[model samples]
Target: MTMKILISDPNKCNGCRMCRTACAIRKAGVCNPEKSRIQVIQMDECDRYLPLVCQNCEDAPCIAACPKEAISRMDDPVLQTVIDYNKCVGCKMCLNACSFGAIGFDEDRGRPFKCDLCGGDPLCVHFCEPGALTLKDSAMIQYDQARTSALRRTVGIRR
Candidate 1:
């Protein structure tokens, strides 16, 4: 009943870029990373490939900042944010507002592009060669549990 976002561990990613190719193929009908919704920024010296995708934030600033209301959470159980291209005004407000740098400009369509989680079955997750990406439930209870455990060992929070 909770929406999920995938994150890549820098240690796991090997700069293979299979995720980027998969994203492009699913979104653009091609295997070109240049047109891919997801991007893999390679830090070659460090042997790392940072897989960048939508974080699917609970308080999504992009949704609030869209002037045309083109971005909306899907009614499905996963509740992914979907951009209605027809309604998008190409103002780039959402792109600027997204802190994760997940949004990209579609030069051909003149609209911003972002990961929609592929309607619950993310191709990036499927095609991640190193198993660097995963779609897990974004549960508040789980987050609270982890936070509480971390805080208990820290000097900041007593409880």
Candidate 2:
């Protein structure tokens, strides 16, 4: 089986924000949407709801941007980018480096947080009742990106 990456279908999202609630509870032991690693962006005027999470890029900018070397991929087979809380010094460089705006800040911890795929079984995916979030083969990411770009063009949404 190929390694999987998290993907989202904005068209399928109903903006219920159940994914956010799931992520927050799993990661932070709380029910705060603000603490959630996955964020639901509501474009009310356009009537679009996008669930944004870390892409876990092969060449992740966050890894390069971290001065403390706090961000790095997991050991073999898991390949997910994770933050080392012990090494993180509250620097927000990773937040700025993420083009997708997937990295989130925890004001209480003063550290950046992002989706780590919940150790390969994401709670967000489990709780996505609309089926907006799913794990796809890593090879399909390029196709998904192209589809997103085309959709944006058709909808007049600029990156």
Candidate 3:
């Protein structure tokens, strides 16, 4: 079986933000949306709701941007790359490097946090009742960049 990557269908989303709540709980052990690795953005004017999370790029820009070598991938069962807050310097370079705007800052903790696929099974995927957020086979991960570019052209959304 192929490893999977998270995908969001803005058209299917209803802006309930359950994914964000679940992400926060799994990643931070809290119920705070602000602490969530995933985020839900509601474009009220356009009537679109987008759930954004780390893309886990093959050539992860976040990993390259971290001067501290704070980010690394887990290669055994899951290939998800994650941040090591201990090595992070709170400089926010990785935050700037992420084009998808998936990396999030913990204001109180002063470190960058992003989706780690919940160590294998993402809580956000489990809690996404609308089916807006789902995991697709990793083969599509490379194509997502081009697809997202096309989506951006259609919707004019930066994220």
Candidate 4:
């Protein structure tokens, strides 16, 4: 089976926030942006809205940061990093460890949450009116090397 990934095209996004509402409803049964796993951040400097979600890093910092080993990468076809709520200790380490600010903290639940791709059918992608969010096979998309370089620069990590 081909590995699937979620892609966000900022150029296509109009900041409508329908994606956030869909995600929140699917995940939390509410239309709250704060509860949405996917977030659209407005870049005032560029007047652009960027939808941010977990990149599913090969070496996910959130997994390593969880002291209770609650966060882990699912094997094989899924390839998603998930948090074991039973084992999670309500720590915000995963939120801090995320480079893209993809992790969200739930104040009521006292837990951090990230995108799970909605078990292979993302509501965020479906509700995205501008087609900014897409689910594509990993093999079909060309990797952006500049993104890696920029991430390293942002984190001050040389690798």
Candidate 5:
């Protein structure tokens, strides 16, 4: 099965962090961004917030850099990349290899963690009030391109 990633449009984010809260609640049974797998980075100067999560890259650098071989991909339809916490040696290699800054340090365990798309359902997307996040297949890239082009045109005309 083909795996997909959810991208957040900075233009659509309002810095509310509802996605983060939802993720934490779903994964850890709490409502905290610090424990949440997803992170929302806000650029106050630009009036924008960008939610970051694992992109599930086909050639994932994190998986390759893992010396302990703790990270591996599941064969499920959603194609989740999961980490074997038992095998993890508390190394930060995966944390450094991820291009999107998706992996975060688990302070309690001194290990790294990231979004596994909530086992395919993606709790973040379900709780996102602004609909800023959506799971899209590879085929949806063209749709995203078109949407961005239209937005650019609208902005250009306004200016």
Candidate 6:
């Protein structure tokens, strides 16, 4: 089985954003959501908060979209996708390819960063007290996603 995968419960999420803060601290050594691998988007009209993170897709398009060969995934005991910033040209191609908008910019290095799942122990899960975020099985996540998709249709922009 794949490693623990991050899941977001939009119904329980109120856009509190403690997950983002925790992620930022764990990854960046400071509290900066801009540098955090995980991000949250708040929809006031819909009264929802959407947490975005790297999905570690089996067929990750971001890996293919990177012309510099900067993005790649390891298929060993744990499935992990890593980005070589030294090789990344910051073309934002991966950003465009990611459907979840999980990719974020690093102003200091001029490179793109994304969730590496805190090296397997996600701090976001520890910080999310309301149970809005948790690490779940990949298979269960897929089933939940399929059901969620069938529940509603995308009417506006695909992005």
- Candidate lDDT scores, in order, read 0.82, 0.88, 0.84, 0.88, 0.84, 0.82
Query: Residue 40, candidate 2: how far off, in angstroms?
Result: 1.4
| Candidate 4 per-residue lDDT over residues 92-134, each given as its tens digit | 9998899999999999999888888988899999899989999
Per-residue C-alpha lDDT of model 1 across residues 1-159, encoded as one tens digit per residue: 666657677788887888888888899898688777787877678677788888777789999999899998775655478889889999999999999888999788798888877877889888888888877766865896898889787856665
Candidate 2 per-residue lDDT over residues 1-159, each given as its tens digit: 356778888899999999999999999999999899898888687768999988778899999999999999865334578889999998899999999899999998798888778877889999999899998776687787899999999999999
CA lDDT for candidate 5:
0.84
Candidates, ranked, TM-score: 4, 5, 2, 6, 1, 3
lDDT of 6 by residue, 7-95 (tens): 78888888888898988888889888777888888867887988889878878999999999999887742447788878999898999
Shift of residue 116 alpha carbon in model 1, Å: 1.1
TM-score of each: 0.79, 0.80, 0.77, 0.84, 0.81, 0.80
Span of 10 residues, lowest total lDDT, candidate 2: 73-82
Expressed as tens digits, the lDDT of each residue in 13-123 for candidate 3 is 989999999988888899989899898888688779999988778898989999999988766445578888789999999999999889989888898888777767888
Q: Tell me, what's the RMSD of every candidate?
A: 3.9, 5.5, 6.4, 7.0, 3.8, 6.3
Q: Which stretches of candidate 3 lie over 4 Å from their true place?
A: 139-159
Q: Higher TM-score: candidate 2 or 5?
A: 5
Which candidate do you rate higher for lDDT, 1 or 5? 5
Per-residue lDDT, model 6, residue 148, is: 71
Candidate 6 lDDT score relative to the true structure: 0.82
Candidate 4 Cα lDDT to native: 0.88
Model 2 earns a TM-score of: 0.80
